[model samples]
Target: MHVPDGFIDAPISAATGVVAAGAIAVSLRGARRELDERTAPLAGLVAAFIFAVQMLNFPVAAGTSGHLLGGALAAILVGPYTGVLCVSVVLLMQGILFADGGLTALGVNITDMAITTTVVAYAVFRGLVKILPRTRRSITAASFTAALLSVPAAALVFTLLYALGGTTDVSLGKVATAMIGVHVLIGIGEAAITALTVGAVIAVRPDLVYGARGLEQRLKLRVNGELVDAQAPLEPATPRTSRRKLWIGGLVASLLLAGFVSFYASSNPDGLEKVAADQGIDQKAKEHASADSPLADYGVRDVDDARLSGGLAGVIGVGVTVVAGSGVFWAVRKRRSTSQAA
Candidate 1:
């Protein structure tokens, strides 16, 4: 969730800021091992796609809505460390450019949404994958389960943060129950999206999916009574679809979702926003620092048509996120290559 300003006091927020910064620094180093030439660009695209999908809020309850939290999806597609960077990039873009999250509390949003979700979900995913089969179906199943749990876990984290530095005097027990309750419903949506997206990619190009890599090599055939490796091809099997084509298709899907489908997204408050207003969490909420930006509130300034304004904003967001994320990943990749070369 995008934590706005005043939900948490300055000291805790600053503490979270340091935590976020340290996590990013470590992630940048770990990402080098994860991102080579083949997967580096795709990692950036995955980040942008998450940004696009997050704009499409689906109805969850009578008044509450939810969108893809994207931790499981990213972790399944890309490595967990890179997954953290992806969501972090989206949060950074939203905070600075779209005013979706507050600048002062950007660290809170990153810690709660990006770092917490990715770390917890990926841990769950790895544990499940070990016990379950290594088939793509099992991967998809693990993704769903991981995503389902991650949202509530994040809510619990927020409850703890609020208990520590809440700006209001709301009941901590009530806050925990309510936040976890609504977020559980949101978790179902998160699970479905994560499973479907991870399933689709694994179906098309399991090689491109970071979490599925080892599983591909483990595919075996039962011969007589023993498990044996599948016969290796003398030559590499020709890919049915080119990486360029897949990239193009993914980009198109992202554009369609954000540009057109987003217009139909439920206008109700999302799980966090709804819970905040209901639980008195927003009693001390402050205005976003970038509220007056031209692209604030997911709309272009002075655009009369709501649809066009939002559409343009969505497109611009996708473009900027892709560029920024790619730049970061490619630089990391280059550094890795240089170090190896030297």
Candidate 2:
């Protein structure tokens, strides 16, 4: 959920800001081990992909719709630390450029959507993979289960946050019930998308999928009573410029998704927003600060055609998000390179 301003009190929001800042700082350091030459560029792509897919909201209930949260998908594709950064990047871009989420509540959104979802989903994924058969199917299954649980976990976290710092005197129990119930339906959609996307990537390039890296044994075949791993023929180390091609390809895909495909997304309020409105949790919500921005509400300013305005805004959002995300990841990669050299 976007969590607009005035939903949470100032003191609690400030406290969450500090907690989010610290968590991001820790994730940056941890991500150094996760983002190497191959994964660093992919991390940025994961962010942009998340940004793109989130634009396509699917109907969940009568009035509620759901979209990809991207924590599990990103974690399965990249790594947990990098996944946090990915969702954070999308949230930041939506806040600053699209005015989808509130600036003042940025920390709240990041904590609930980025940090909580990634942490819970990754933990569940690791646990399930440990017990299940080490097959690609098992990995897909684990991804599905982890993604399914992550959405409700995030809803619970928001419930707790609202209990502590809610601006209105709504019943905490009722809020929790409604939030969890609606988000569970949303979680199903999240699970399907995460599994399908992870499955597609694993099919094409399992080497690029962080969660499937050590699980390659599942793809091995038995030869003369001995197991032989079916690893892709190792490529001689190539120039770093090759990675730029991948980055460019990912950015182009994100642009296509947002620029054209997003026009077909359902025009209904998402799960959280619908639930809040139905249950009166949104009664205390305030307007977004950047509501007056040209690209506010995912439309270009003075554009009469709804399709053209939304399409242009979506394309600009993808462009801005990819640039911002790639810059952060490239800096992290460079720092890692420098440290290794030293």
Candidate 3:
């Protein structure tokens, strides 16, 4: 959920801000180990894909909808630290450009949506992967389970945060129940989306998926009296054209989803919004600081046509997010190279 301004007290907001900043600082360093020639570019695509998917909120309940949080999906596709950065980038873009989330509560959104989801999802994913068979199917199954649990974990974190600094008088128990209940259904959708995305990537390029690393154990060959790891058969190197095709295909899919398909997404309020309206948690919610921006609320200001405005904004968002995310990852990759050289 994207917490709005004034929903949380100033003290709690500032505290969460500090926490978010620290998490980002640490992730920046950790991501260095995760980003390589194959993964760095994919990381940016993952972020952009998340942004695009989040725009298409599917109906989860009668009057509530849910979107892909992208934590489990990103962590499964890329790496956990990079997943955190990926979701954080999306939140930042939403807040500043689209006015979807509150500027003052940016830290809360990051803490709940970015840090909490990624940590919990990755932990669950790794645990399940270790216990389950080391097959591609097992990876997909783990992705589904990890994503299924992550949504409720985020809701619980929000409830705890609200209890600490809620600006409204509401029953904490009711809020918790409602939040958890709706998000559980949302979690199903999350699981399906995460599983399908991870499965597709694993099918095409399992090596590109960080969670799928070491999945294929090397065969052993008997040498003399001892068995030793056999050298893998040398295969033709993957062509640069093939890599370019994958990247281009992903970008085109993202554009189509955000620019065209999003127009038909459900109009119902999401889980958090429905709960807030029901539980009075949004009584003191304030307008976003960027509400007056040209691209606020996922539409271009002064654009009368809804479809055109929204489509244009969505396209622009994908473009900007991809550029920004790619820049960050490329810089991290470069820093890693410099350190290795030193």
Which candidate's TM-score is highest?
1
Candidate 3 off by > 4 Å: 217-241
> lDDT per prediction?
0.88, 0.86, 0.91
Q: Per-residue lDDT tens digits of candidate 3, residues 63-139?
A: 99999899989888889999999999999999999998899899999999999999999999999888885578889
Q: Write the per-residue lDDT of candidate 2 for residues 1-342, one digit (tens) a residue.
A: 888888888988998899889988988988898889888878888898899989989988887788989899988888999899999999999998888877888999999999999999999999998999777888899999999999999999999999999888888888999899989999999999999988866665666788886763435788999998765432223333455665677678788888899999988999778767876777888888888999999999999999899889988888788788889999998999999999
Cα displacement (Å) at residue 22, model 1: 0.5
What local lDDT does model 2 show for residue 176? 94
List TM-scores for all candidates, in order: 0.95, 0.92, 0.94
Q: Which ranges in model 2 have alpha carbons more than 4 Å from their true place? A: 218-249
Instruction: Single out the weakest 10-residue window by summed lDDT for candidate 1.
Output: 231-240
> What order do you get sorting by TM-score, best first?
1, 3, 2
Judged by lDDT relative to the true structure, which candidate is superior, 1 or 3?
Answer: 3
Give model 2's TM-score versus the native structure. 0.92
- For model 1, the superposed segments whose C-alpha errors exceed 4 Å read 216-237
Count of clashes, each model: 0, 0, 0
* Cα error, candidate 2, residue 207 (Å): 1.1
Ranked by TM-score, the better of candidates 2 and 3 is 3
